[model samples]
Target chain A: MKIPLPARFRTPVLLMAGLTLLVALATAIGSEQLNFTLTEMLIRMIVVIGLYMFVGNSGIMSFGHIGFMGIGAYVTAWATLAPEWKQVMLQGLPAFLQEHTYPFPVAVLASGLVAAGVALILGAAIMRLNGLAASIATFAFLAIVYSVYSNWESVTGGTSSVIGIPTVVGPWTAVAFACLAVVAAYAFQVSRYGLMLRASRDDEVAAQSSSVDIVRVRLVAFVCSAFLVGMGGALYAHFLGVLTTDAFYLALSFVTLSMLVVGGIGSLTGAVAGTLAVTLIVEILRACERGFALGGAQISLPRGSQEIGLGLALALVLIFRPAGISRSREL
Target chain B: MVDPLLRVPQPTAAELAAEGVSVRFQGLAALSEVNLTLLRGEIVGLIGPNGAGKTTLINCLTGFQRPTTGRVALAREDTAGWNPARFRKAGVARTFQAGRLFRDMTVAENVEVTGVGLGLDRKSAHSVAMEVLDWLGIADKAARTAGTLDYTDERRVGIARALVLPPAFILMDEPAAGMSDSEGEDLVGLVTSIPTKFGCGVLIIEHNMRVIMNVSHRLYVLDGGRTVAQGTPAEVQANPAVISAYLGADV
Candidate 1:
């Protein structure tokens, strides 16, 4: 039987079907914990896929992308916070920003746009660098952003958690955003610019001589990925109903990066798989720590078993399959 | 065979000239006072011993390197200090010494991407990729991943990539480097067709004397970052300075 969609789309369609099934099953069970876990997985998928859109195609690892998430979370908090709360909490805000509260969707969109704009400015400076230098530059950028957000007491909550963000991003909303992210990433990946960027990533000199415009392509990928990741950040803020700089700092960056690396640093399928696998492993390890019944006996792991076990599992996966579980193969 | 009144006149091909170009790395000069010219529809071979500044000169002409003391003029426009993409947009295409095809893409994509990068629409780029691959006689390998190609096919895809740009001037750097004698002969045949069939100028940097001598209309010999000889292949062959600088020791 002839399939209706073109062959190129089959893998992504299958992937989407699988993801939808996961969401459906989670929602149907009506387990709040399962729904929350699935929601967290979806948000991480958005961020990891967003990271993949740039790092996978451009062949440059960016530690600074989490900074965009931080920016997005803060922007959402700024826009969605009650005017009276904002006036008391963020006195450094300009009168206009302190006066109005926008819709959740608008806040999300605004945060994404703001992060993309910041990416544009940062990429102009950072994309000129290549390889390890560029990676370090991104780390520096992340550090700079973290330092500013950590100390900007009036504009941001500054080291304290910003509260009352309104938990509106349920599992369904998260899945919707994740689906949008997947489509956006797939669309960009197959676009002319994406092809050009990947070409440049594979062989820079050849790409440049072929007129691929390396810097421009890199900048475009950076901005687009930042915007998507920023949206993920907004979702996270609303999901948690609070925000802190630490949530978008090294812990989030490394966890997301580990997920990306474990899944397959080169493919979208890897991103989704890595996020799900890591999240499941973390949950299982946490359960183990809290004590579990096995063979009719109570078994308990150490308190830090989640972190140690996750690290050990990642190491074993890398040792067995250096390219990650996916090995760069896409759906 | 055709009516003279119906045939349109061909526009004269533009000239690409590098005048007194020099490249210095720190205190050492890679290319000093190197001068070369390639006219549209002309095949110019640049031959040199190892480290004779042949590739450096090519880099200068193609805008990959900035000449510290000279200029690259394309159709009378000074193109010195321009990036490689700008040079490509201005119709200067080049193949790398290594066949640096995008490993993940198929053979046809290597060509198609270049065409698209050069401003061809996707539909046209696809057709152009097919046409160019067919023209290069590598049409059968179009669906194969570029990284999996055998040596000769890699070279052909590299040439096909540059040709798809349909450039005004195409530079081939060591295209025949790793080929067998028969393969070199086949490449010579294929490269000889480039200028005439594609209606573009060619600057071929080859270590294979047989290919360079057989294919280029004129040959320029470089030694120690300076042009030692330039003339018809026969004329360049008989030049004593060229012979001593490159050929005498080997030949």
Candidate 2:
């Protein structure tokens, strides 16, 4: 008799297929309300999977991923914005940057490339450090990037933000990219480099003795993760028709990390679940804020309550599940 | 019979050598001015007491720790300047005490990573990994995660991982630490056979006396951060220093 596929492979295949079909159907038949929500959640899903590439494989917690997203968003915004509109928003720009207007796909590609390039430079330095030191170094990197984005008046439009980004990322595009991210993340997880990265994470001494180039493996994941996260950022920039350094700040970093932590740290399905669950929770909180008006007293909740909720959820998940919702298993 | 007076000329190179290597942690000398040499195709055992510098020597050799003084050379090429991965790529591989297999990875996957690290393509690495697993008699467990294995099996898997890279030198830290008598014997047999089978020098740090006596062609006894004795197993076991170190004042 032929042996059946193991539960591990079977479960993920079935779950991924179901999710793909659900996303397709929702994008096709659902109202614009549902479509927009699914699209946004799918985009976040891509970002989370990108996070999983580095965080999951290397078993390192990073606070610098948002730095990559900022790089992508600004690159995409600069590429896709109309020349005259860019002049109005950006004012004094370099001659070469001002003259060129890239197509949407080309802009997204550029965003990923720029992010990977930055990751390559940064990862070479950051991956050398170990454990909490590496964590602190990456956090410092994020802070530095955020500060640069907030202060760089000409290139990044300063803290005022850059608007008039092209609307190229829609519901279908988001779903398609999310699927691609899932496949890419899963492929990396199963590849030789992925095994080496995970081995290094599990046992540094053994990995070293085995001659595994831990730093190089981590750089691979770091650059790949940055590329995907940059793509997600480009999609977000187009979806919103605006881009800001603040859009890719620590708050968004924490949100994305919370999704990964609350879902599961090392599993692809956990990334998607965490993103979808967190996004829905934020949407619901927003709806409650708008809908609730008690007895004309106007008892209004403060903004960004979703962040507080997410933080609490992350803490509770860490305390209770410890391995996040999926444990070490995939969705 | 070999002529007792005939002197063999010294080889042009020592396969692996440590000169005046010392590792001090907070003024405590874990290893002190240790000098060792292993010729090609030799199996050497490092035997010591609990606090003896056996593991520290291995760590220094593998580039996990920098020696406070002196130099380590592999094939007469200075390795003191090399990092762990550089050491590994330059034909050094190691196995840890308690078998530090990647818990989340399958046994075959663990070996495959080692093969890949040695510059094998994926298809070839997969086959090589399976071959190693089969050689170690853990082929059936190839699909099983390293964490799911028993202590003996995990030890075997660790050896398989080390051997997959086919390094010129393999350092094993306490390979027989937690094994039963028969398992330890099997490990001793496996390690002893590696030099002939794979043509790789083996340096084993083991606390198990039976394993040391069985597998080691030459043995180094260390105590209090110094070499107490070095000789063939029969010669070393009969040495006053080795006896005193092991038996204490009772001897």
Candidate 3:
């Protein structure tokens, strides 16, 4: 789903399908280290696609999406954690989450729903603002969610990590969810509401005059985008078997959004491509930081170089290809 | 495809009116105590010089502006607090002086979005979009990126977007702004046919006296935001106030 996709829509769909195939092939044939990196990269891809569904179509950047991801991770963690673990760590949880362990699929569905529910309530108020003010409000929202989760000890385990989540999700499952996000986001990209959302983004005056309810369409996208990002968070919890609110804080927001800008903020292809390119680049940078022998000489970069490298990459993309590597085109 | 969206109920004797409407921005009066009416099955011309508040009145009638001292009514109900989007959804559409097409979208998407906003499913919206684009003779340009169009075609696409709404009262603001003489003549045919062909009332804002006079079933003339004269084309042409307001601008 590139921005300004020609009406055909098949090529971008095929592109996402192709991404799934490569992930499957990698996990099946590649080494353990490669599988680990692929899983993380695919999860980031799903998160970016969720971001694209709202930011790409509505032209509203959000710093709060990772906040949804945190909510989802926590919800899924609460659902799937061993009852004994929950009873110990999250004493303030409702009776249902504290005493019962749901099936993994049920936990996953609950994560998306809870995130979407929060989005609906918040978006109703925030979507009334436009442009920069709305963006800042979303950042504030993320900060508030972060502060609450970090301090709500009994319900959220406070600042401590909640463990004992089953680590059942692998690279193949990540790929499947990534593919599902792509198809759903693509369907929205071509649907009536998507077209209207993009229209409103292009020219608000023109769109409203055409009878497009600016706030309503924006809120709908906000809720739907939150649902997807929330599901991405669930995948993270299951993959790591741990939950930490700080992991879903400012750093995660910046890193995922950077992938979007580096790939193509306006197109679905850009979202996927950005995640793939940035994740791989960060992994390579880390691998370099941990010294490797090259022709009997130790080849290594200084520690903390990944941040510098990622920052430089983001800067270059912004200055040279402001539309992202996909140039906002799907094909 | 059946084009259910384009098959609007025929000519329900609709009326959009302004009673004693006036607008003041801070201290300057843009329009004062102005009255205008448009009815279905008719073509009405609203002509005035620059800053005469032709577009301002268009805004007021279509809910873009709230009159300081009057009410705008659609059919029989007062549209006092409606927004522009509600106005469009209620079957009143207006064009801007600036042809504000969604530059990044294809022309077809630009028109189809209106159908969707007005409650059509995507499939029906597409059918209506193609139907109206065909009617406006820009069906070939339906897939073209709207931003790439020349000024004249941009205006054409703007008109096509408005027509897709199938509005009961379509208020056109300088619909022929960038056209050549021949293109202007073509616009005359399109503007005049809107009432009979699409079953809508037309309010055309134009500087070109000849074109509006040629097509309007009735004429409403304004000067300095005041009603100067209104009647049949011949009656308004013979009025001294009308001639003086023209000031030899267009005879």
Q: What is the lDDT, from 0 to 100, of the residue A77 in candidate 3? A: 93
| lDDT (Cα atoms) of all candidates against the true structure | 0.87, 0.83, 0.88
Off by over 4 Å in 3: A1-9, A292-299, B1-13, B248-251
- For model 1, the stretches where C-alpha displacement exceeds 4 angstroms are A1-4, A295-297, B1-13, B249-251
lDDT of candidate 3 over A283-304, digit per residue (tens): 8899999989989999999998
- Per-chain TM-score of chain A in candidate 1 equals 0.96
lDDT of 1: 0.87
Give candidate 2's whole-model lDDT: 0.83
The lDDT leader among the candidates is: 3
lDDT of 3 by residue, B23-90 (tens): 99997889988999999879999987788888989999888899999889888789988999988888
TM-score, every prediction: 0.94, 0.91, 0.94
Q: List the residue pairs that clash in candidate 1.
A: none
lDDT for position A29 in model 1: 98
Please write out the lDDT profile of model 2 over residues B38-127, one tens digit for every residue.
Answer: 776899999888889888898888888899999898877877678887777777778888688899888888888777766665556778
Better of 1 and 2 by lDDT: 1
